[model samples]
Target: MKADTVGQEAADGLLPVLRELCRGAGADGSLPLTPRALHAAREAWGAAALLRLSGIARVLGEVRLSRRAVFHYSNPDCPCCRHKLTPNERAFLSLVRAGIAGQKTAATGAALILTEGGPVEPARNAALALRGVWSAGPV
Candidate 1:
């Protein structure tokens, strides 16, 4: 996991939210997360998560989102490095690929992602945070 990701998860309050995403990814843990129960989740998680997802949609180059709730990652490889993405990475990539983007104005959604409401273990949090950004490979 990346320090920046841990920092962001700590500061932004995205672990449990991400945990929930991982929970939804099912046994395989591969990306293109299409959580079966999104309507119920959106209410509990708020639309901002979707907006954060939109930011994800903007970040990844290959993906297909049928709607704000539906996410599909075409090439679920790390944009920065072609690493075997973790389940947590898959979930974040889903968000990164989910539609409903509005980084510039999705204040409500962004706040939901950062709202103080959960605990994030350092190691686990680091792994989860690492899913979002690119990392360098061994030289």
Candidate 2:
């Protein structure tokens, strides 16, 4: 199958595992993730993928983890190349922020930009350092 198709299928299969891990890890389920919890979640997801239990593992290995637990982006392609971001790219990024966990403030969600190459640890680390800029005034 095509890489994109494989990635979608893998992500589809991985979501349940992630949810289960979140529940087991005592995730709020509603609120954003704590740094520690996000780490655990990332590890759990990676392990699941590593175990070859789901296709997501193959794609996930390529994702980079962002500081915020969830990333929101309109396009699924590489921002620079405009090419479709491969499953490996997503997985590599997913792992990038495995160490970060906290409520983001500046943006409601993060943007997972696609880049070509092996894992970019430095960029991921920088992203982790950013304090979540919470939304404006009172709720």
Candidate 3:
């Protein structure tokens, strides 16, 4: 845990988020040492953690590449989604918004995650998940 993840007791809840980070960074996840840690994490967290990470990276990538302020817009309704924002997502979104506004919050290095060329890097592959979530995603 990064000491900022709200509601969760420990870092075990962050495996999915980490996986998203690695995935967004284009990691194939085939490193020799990755499986051992992944297996342990999977055993500890179970399948839901993995399954819940759907589209997070894509949405975050959109947010990172956003030229407009995401927090300024209302999150669009999606009847297909059966979930809402979690405390963790709210907190992370606040941090990201604050970071974007140049506020001096604790979520340092958020700028790094908003890498240039992420959105237009691959054939306008940017996702529409950002329309549903201005702050965070399913994870």
Candidate 4:
């Protein structure tokens, strides 16, 4: 993940938290965060936890959030290459379009998707720094 996307601090802290969550994942080996669950988690565990979960969600390719302040693209095709978008690219483009049209409910939500990934494989870490941040009210 690019540090610039979600700020250096959040980028640094996010991976370790995701690693911890991966270790404790359910039998399905998937970590899913519904919008409702994400909001509830924020209320119970503070906004930091929501940020962490959003980071993981972004990695899982479950959410796409535009970092740009303004929408630019019109065609789903590659602007420079002028080629048809791949399926993944099309999905991302659709999400961005939905976001622009204010049709995606997730756009109103607080989860700030930091990076893009298809299937993320988190590295295991011995220590988790985010444990405290989860219940610490706010950062």
Candidate 5:
């Protein structure tokens, strides 16, 4: 079978398993898989392929994307310190808040980036800053 076909098959097969894993983890109060965890999952699933193709990795990519969306929707602030938030966290929060405010995610992301003091080299920093501003409130 072609690599793409194999990958699609693998991903389709793995989706239910992955979802079950996530649901079980959530039930146990464990956080969803981190990037590293997702990578590991991809590797484990891809092991079946004699020659791993990029398509085979899409299963993990979808997991990561779903996780990101969940994280963004949750708008989790730093538990230890509210002032501090990760870039991904910020991006997610921006998406959620903007959605709540009836704004589009793309526009919100762009506006957040533009509001930064200058060019945002490490994109994450700009994202975090935008989240801070969007979430900031009266002291």
Candidate 6:
């Protein structure tokens, strides 16, 4: 993940935002993975992370690609997604937001999972659960 010009943390943290952006796609059908979309995402995320998240969501059967190169998530408002996250989840969110925004997680001894886009990718995908937990990390 770090090797992809973006750190693992930000890459993970942006998943929820990416998911939401996809949710916001709504009646539009799909959102193109373009620079315009990247700009619409909070500055805490970058193009690389967005692309990676899009890929991961695609693999997870969450995002769908259309002939026009646009994508949308499977379910925008699943009931299970409304629950609160755990401490580890919060930690990952903090690190992800920090990394994307070019900052650092304030938590001491915060050991977070890292990856280079392999099996660990699924673990990183779970960070998408951090959607509603970003009240402090980043917008």
Best by TM-score: 3
lDDT of candidate 4 over 21-43, digit per residue (tens): 33343444455665544544455
**lDDT (tens digit, per residue) of candidate 3 on 22-71:** 33342222222234334533554455433323333443444444423322
Q: lDDT winner between 2 and 6, please give it.
A: 6
User: Which ranges in model 2 have alpha carbons more than 4 Å from their true place?
Assistant: 1-85, 96-99, 102-121, 130-139
lDDT of 2 by residue, 11-111 (tens): 43333333333333322323233353345335544443323222222222223232334322213234542234444334433432232332332111222
**TM-score for each of the candidates:** 0.24, 0.22, 0.28, 0.24, 0.24, 0.28
lDDT of 5 by residue, 69-113 (tens): 332111112343322333433343343334334455453463344
lDDT of 6 by residue, 26-80 (tens): 4544444545335535354454455444533342222222122333222325654
Q: What is the lDDT of residue 4 in candidate 3?
A: 29
Model 4 RMSD vs true structure? 15.4
Q: Give the Cα error of residue 27 in candidate 3, in Å.
A: 10
TM-score of 6: 0.28
Candidates in order have lDDT scores of 0.32, 0.32, 0.35, 0.33, 0.33, 0.38
TM-score quality measure for candidate 4: 0.24
lDDT of 3 at 80: 29
Model number with the top lDDT: 6
Global CA lDDT of candidate 5, please? Answer: 0.33
Q: How do all the candidates rank in terms of TM-score, highest first?
A: 3, 6, 1, 4, 5, 2
Which is the better candidate, 4 or 6, if ranked by lDDT?
6
